[model samples]
Target: MAMRKFLINFNYLNNYKNQAVRFLTTASTLSKNSEVLNETATELVKSIVEEYENKGKMFTLPWVDQHAINSALYPFKELLNLGIQPEFLEDACLHEEKLFRSMIKNGQSIYKMLTIFVENFIMNYEDSIRMFAKWCDLLENETPQSIQSRINLFSGRGLASGIGLRRIFEKCPELLFGSEVQKMDICLEQISNFFESGDLKTIVNNTPHICLLDPTELESKYEYIYFHMGFVSEELAKSKCWMDLDLFSIIDRHSLLLKTGKYFYPDPKRPQLKKENPSPELIFDTPENKFANLVAEVEYEEWLIFRELCEQQRRLEDKQEPYEKIKPSQRKAFERRLKEKRENMEGEIE
Candidate 1:
């Protein structure tokens, strides 16, 4: 028993000595490598300065020290290896100095960042540079876990994956920068409830900016289009411009179409009535001039005048005063003018 105890102690001491020796060797190697890295960093900075001077361009870089330069070495090398041009890096240092410095200071890996965008998202080098500042800000502000959560949010869902996700991130890169997972989830849930699975996919894939809108606002628009206008999920999905229109614009345009006898809400009991009604695309997808001339069959001037009237009415409503009560005479005159315009429009149509 005594011999066995002694042997165990002897083995443990031997292992400890081996570990200490390896640690010392590693420290010595790192010290030598760090000196080389610092020298390379110094030459890089000097070259950048010389290039700016030769070009007679104003250059700005964040205050860098031996530590900052040392921190930046690995990222700089990684960026170069990832096919980022030296000029692009120099431009980024000059134009986005603070962001570039912050990214290095935070120990964010440039290689991993490029890999996420280039490999996972399939963005090209040009696309990455176009959004370089935003990418840096996103990496600087968000944790790896938070960014991964957002990635999962987009990737896990069938509505947005692969090409769909690439489209979304390309359009709205800011979506990954904030603590908006809860809000985004709620918006997506609301959209899914209102739309069929295929329609939801089309809507999100076409208009990724919809993800940035307030959940309540999106729900309100859906309700108005679905319940009030009698537009189905498929119709709403096909009309890609509808979500871009404000609620008031939609309301006023639809009301004008109703007054002009050009649009009717879908009613199952009256199948024949649906035949003459303009499609949602014709109504919502067109500009004021085209919508007025083609769908409403009214003059563009008339539509402009009506839009102004709608704005005034909305302002009065917000002030808790009805237009009829606040300016009854003016409202009557305006209605008379509108009636005359409609009658003239009818005459021209006939």
Candidate 2:
């Protein structure tokens, strides 16, 4: 009986010893994992602080605070995971400090917003960062659903596809913000009256900034091009820089061409009489020097003098000041040169 008790006691003591060893081993593993996690987190925080110090403004607060570091950690990691460059994040922080803070505070929403641009709009990391930073204020107030709706305002109308919308945004990112949709819709509707859907799409796609103009201004520009200049919708659509030119610039250049006998208004009944003139692209797209030297074949100094005089006249007229005509001698001198040029052009034609 004594031997049996002793053996049982020995077995119990051995089992207790094994259990204690296993417990100690598990505790040690847990402690090591905790230390590793803490170290990783610390390193991440240090790296972020280093990035900010490298790229942030000299006068900005130090980024060494524990709260600030903790706040930025997850968002920075997420953004880096999304392939956004640390440089861009620094720029965003410097550009809009409070906005960046707010965005990072709700890291998930901002992440979702960027993800939408990446996956849905097919934007690469650089473009996504640009678009986000450009309109971060407006985007902060927006949800991902609202952003999708805004995108659909352009793409869903068959105006542009995903890639096309991307192009439009690349050209004029302000269109992504609020109230621009209403303006765009109104402008497109007005333009549609004059141009076919295809031509209108091409024009907007090529020069997305045109949608930023007032509706009335857009209408007046179209009327002048269509009615006064005698350009058809297809022709105007093909002129990529036509909408880019100011109305007065168009008028001044066109008037000069008419005065020089280089261009004539197209008459449907007398199409044969239309001489070869500069195309709309050549007239509007060329720089001042090229237009003067090649298109008008005038001395550069003469065009500059004429442009200055015209600007003076317009400014005086705008201010409702009394307009005095140029002195007779001055008029005669200017007209004499123009007369000689006209005669020379006629001689060449003959």
The candidate scoring highest on lDDT is 1
Residue pairs clashing, model 1: none
- Per-residue lDDT over 1-350 for candidate 1, one digit per residue giving the tens place of the 0 to 100 score: 32233334334433444465453557665564444334433444445555566669544445456565555566655554344545556566666655455545654454455556665566775465455565676667666567667767767777676556778776777777774888887888878888999898888778777877877767667666665566788888988788788877888888899889876655556676678887778878999899999988999999999989989878776854221221324644544554566568769989
Candidate 2: residue 72 lDDT (0-100) = 49
Candidate 2: stretches off by over 4 Å: 1-46, 50-103, 124-146, 268-275, 304-350
- For candidate 1, give the lDDT of residue 136: 78
lDDT of model 2, residue 196: 89
lDDT of 2: 0.65
Candidate 2, residue 280: how far the Cα is off, in Å: 1.3
TM-score for each of the candidates: 0.66, 0.61
Best candidate per TM-score, number?
A: 1
